[model samples]
Target: MIACGEKRLSQKRKRPNILFAIADDQSFPYSSAYGTSGINTPAFDKVANAGVLFNQAFVAAPQCSPSRAAILTGRNIWELEEAGTHGSYFPKKFTVFTDLLEDVGFEIGYTGKPWGPGDYSKAGWTRNPVGPEFNRKKLTEVPADGIHKTDYFGNFVEFYNQKGNDDPFFFWFGCHEPHRVYEDGSGLKSGKLLTEVDVPDFLPDNKLIQSDIADYAVEIEWFDQHLGKMISFLEEQGELENTIIVVTADNGMPFPAAKANLMEYGTHVPLAICWPAKFKGKRITDDLVSLIDLAPTFLEIAEVENVPQMTGESLKDILFSDSQSKINAVREFVLTGRERHTHARPDNLGYPSRAIRTSDYLYVKNFKPERWPAGDPVPESAKQIIPAEGFKELWPGYQDIDPSPSKMHLLHEKDSLSRYFKLAFDKRPMEQLYDIKKDPACINNIANDSTYATIKKELRDLLESELKKQGDPRVLGFGEIFDSYPRTSKMREFKGFNKRGKYNPKFTQKDQQIIE
Candidate 1:
């Protein structure tokens, strides 16, 4: 909550500094502000308590690279050609808000991760779209296992020192923690009890799964720790109240059926914005919002004109409004989708799908229903092959879902956890409808249920119409165009790739050259 009397900055002051802190692979309701157990996020809670806490925030896509790309360009994934997919080139034609800000007077730079596992170099970009890199700072003593050694806050301080005396700064504090490769039992070792873990219904409610989640909490706390330090640094520099701070994640937590799926757990993420001198504090809004809206918001706040082609609307109305809940009644629905994530499927094919999420329901359309949602069941190379460099070793089968302890447990104990495994890795139908109020986990599909036939039809029509309007190639009868994008990451050989015969030399040869 805000203080009884808060100080406001002068209206004639220089442009507001933008400190955007984004966590990797974090899900909604995972912070202490949401009353979630096991994880402690004082930094996130402080921002939410001091500003606007969004209850229904979702990303443009479920995966990291594409989702970050959407946020940078303020456009839907389908609208961004190769940048729409993970581990692909970002076309040079796309204009990022950061570049626009830099063309003005803002001093821009980023620490930790910024806009890739993909190559912006191949896309003919000289620097990261977010800004210049400021990751030169490093920690002398590493804090914990699985936590990156990069000193995120220290880099921010370095960037601050390099800024001009009269120039406003925009820094991207991207944290690499909480993505994956967590140290086992790290949370338990950090004094968190297993009972504190609230296991999602989709996963087995057992000690192994609980511990895996606890370990995830450990990484999340690490990310928050750096954020708290950053906030304090800005305050110490007398720039806290003047900076427009936005805290959120690129996508949901990395887990089976979560990070890579279009389900609520995958697309929904935590969002909090604080500008004590501007936006009202201690407010929580449930209106559906997409991450793509953030780019335009930043541009509008910076007073940048001649904006690029973008699909997202600016959040100035909702942000500056005094009303807490439903500031913009017209902002009812948000759309999310995904293409390729990892080199899992045959010929690097992706599970393409899109969804329309409203307050009460989520309707998804799986364009390639014949393909596996997670990945193919068999690998053409070997039953036990190590993944590419810097990536965790993925066990054979269901490679779209990252390698994790929960994944291993389910696969090893498939007989007992068959239902859960199917929910995570099995093929899905062409259309799926879920009542969010009743089924938050999305375990039951009611697409074919006659009782909700009208709702399903209405949702389908709305989803298709909106997607078509957005110029999504999937609905425009050339959905195969998505498969043509070259993946810059490692390629996997699945068992039936040759038999399926979907591979095309026009794209595959170019992709092979990039990969090699």
Candidate 2:
């Protein structure tokens, strides 16, 4: 007795609802689901147990703005122009997957952080690129320090209430957890013992560092808690079976040599996806997946076409298939890179670098080896004379690395802990190579050693070939254009860099054609 239009609407409603939950600045192997002991992530574990847990998920860029941009557009970071760089304007020409979904009659909304630390308003968009906002709710008391007090669960309830009964909704649950400025000893206060934390080989083993990691674990737990609530809400609404839930992070944890660097911990992120109606559950795949793959995957799942510009491959087949061996064989490697992360360098220049990670080895090409890898060697506070201690002088300009207890310990004990400090803050060679299986921390570089010469060349050639195919400006000899792009963020003054506020004259409007 229903009308034809009503029947079509009902058919659309049968399509899956997408609930994408992203944690800010969380790395892989931090969740209990991954056997990382310090943190208990019941929500992440539930998704993994109920669906597919991707062991090798990576972000296109190590920094937030660019990484989120790549995930939204399904393209390489360099192809995005201003959006490719950190804290820059989002050019309106590049289409975001959310806008495409919205145009196709999908009711999309997001709570908390959504695609920015940058200016999207300049692109003429009325709201965040993710979708319309639903973050008016507030929490009376947050569970821990360094956690945003946004009532994410309450906001999701409000979002669901506003949804039409027949609408297939796409909701972005972006949690601003595990970023920075943690309350010292908050994790220990929460009953998490320091002994439970596993310190990476790159960092010195000390109580301060352990406690800092514990605090980071606490924030991740906060994100997981919100995820649990949202999942419960979906189940209560009877939308759990048909809904596709993806749990992941924007980038790695905020720490020295992790967040901004192109190391393993920097780009590698945790991922779990579930949809009971379409895919088999309780599967684990070691397929190499880039966050960019999610945009195309979502579009395909929704059956919305017209994504010719998307360079990322859709993982729909892999997700829906019950064959674990077949899914793992699809992707062999993943590419990740970075441009401007922060205005830490002279003239706000970024440490432009490209990297390729295969099953066994990781190869990195630092385009500007002359520049300091972390940041400038001088501290922002020290204007005139360089401090007598080399470590003290470098403290202010190591802004590329986040300030943390680990970094502080390394700096304070630099007299005896010089090796650790050098591993994190020193300058580097043009080419770097590491056997990630043996050296996951990426502390040892064997690019020049004759033993790894073959692997170094092979990885370098593969990385260059892929970059050229993608038309990356960095590989196309206009890499300086990335440095030339106008940064919309607040500019900081660095000594000897007179062009702090000015764009590079070498770059011209015609240079943008390279990206097109």
Candidate 3:
């Protein structure tokens, strides 16, 4: 018979550890756990089966830096000022949750990609906003085509070992998978069949596109494989049950009309959380959740005081509740937006956009509709703006769109495949709306349609009101300040000249012949 003292000791609870595993540029419906067939993600599946799988999880923004900033601060993109735009500085005033966790005796560390593509030091941050780095470990056998070969599993083991057995910890495993610049034929080499690839409607169905997607699958598998190893390590240490494991991605798949766009694929991310000590397993919820909610959720779980600046609500109620029904009916809509994605445009201006997504509809407001939606049509060559010779050379006009087989195909067949090309790269209207249920691809614009006018107005009003309440500078009539923010990355030169030796026109006007 167990002693009373031993039983009391066994029943004692410790603060929950946090394991945040975020994939770079991965989208929902890509992981096999989410019913995607081409990719296999046993790790994500394990977490889903062991806890709650969120069918509708979204990021605050569609770009990397801003999306991650929102996840770290639990605030909207526009609220972040310089940090709100891509490749800009992270201001120190915006205290990250990790810093808060670290102050309260949490052993926090991160490996691989944390908060980046921007300078954190410029903001006087001593370390990366996520946490101190732990990427010294290396991998032996990794795909040559993949991005970083940081031994994420090994580094995590090191981090775990450094923490005492009784210490509560927070580890960020940011995998740089499935981003881009994939090795050609890596997927085929890995035995990923082309037929198994599920191509999105926006892109043409062809061998080249299939192969590209297969390569993406290979990278995603790599991320999952590492995650499985980490889970195994946690289970071995008997820390699995008490740990809060959150698996998701920063944004959507890196492709044309995705990634940087506030479209369905761009913002909708796969999410699964496991905390065996507090919640029942095998439950699925359609409750709309924002990635920003994660910051407050972590603070609440740790019994830490939430910062007043955090606008996102905690998901603790939804996560801990036994019921499978919608945890909060108020969580019906999620807001996602985007600023500069890359220094692809002239003067490093970003195509500012904001969007609101409900169960049935998606409403997007392109603030600078006259500007090239994708990117400047002509490449700012060596700081010299060039004239368009022919459509062939200038196929992928919008430099914001990542160079891919599908992108090239669209560019090559833009004349013949006008509709598809337009859907991916053409200039968009000021207001765009889509009935997501009928058109998940977001190809159909119903903003001007008489049938959706009511829905559009409702969503638009809600989105703008929220922006105002949040003090978004864009809506506060200081929107031009976002364009004026200095880009930390190398500036692409295109602001100096036009064909007639006239100073290059600001990209906001629709009359700019360079873009037209």
Predicted structure with the largest TM-score when compared to the true one: 2
**Against the true structure, what is each candidate's TM-score?**
0.92, 0.94, 0.91
* Candidate with more favorable, higher TM-score: 1 or 3: 1
**Candidates arranged by lDDT, highest first:** 1, 2, 3
What clash pairs does model 1 have? Answer: none
Top lDDT model: 1
**Cα lDDT of model 3 by residue, 1-516, tens digit:** 879966643433356899999999898888887787778999999998889999989999888889999999999898887778887778888888999888766899999999978888856888899988899999777875555779999999999998866678999999999788799898899888999898888877789889988998998888998999999999999999999999999999988778888888889999999998788889999898999999999988887764656888999989988878587888989888888776666566779999999988899999998788778876544224333343233434677887887777887888988888898788899899999889998888988999888889999999999999988877997677676555666554455321221112443334312211
RMSD of each: 5.5, 3.0, 5.9
Question: What overall lDDT, based on C-alpha atoms, would model 1 receive against the true structure?
Answer: 0.85
Clashing pairs in 2: 379-396
Pick the winner on TM-score between candidates 2 and 3: 2
Candidate number with the higher lDDT (1 or 2): 1
lDDT of 2 by residue, 1-516 (tens): 999998889778867899999998999988898899888999999998888998889999998889999999999898888888887767778899998888777889999899988878767778888889998999989877667889999998899898887888999999989888788899999999898897888887789889999999999999999999999988888999999999999999888778988988899999999997878988888778899999999998888877757878888877987867437575778899998877777666789999999878889999999888788866535646555343352445677887787777877788788988888888889999989889988989989899988889989999999999999988898788888766666665554333433455556446353221
Off by over 4 Å in 2: 325-330, 379-395, 496-502, 506-516
Clashes of each: 0, 1, 0
Whole-model lDDT, model 2: 0.84
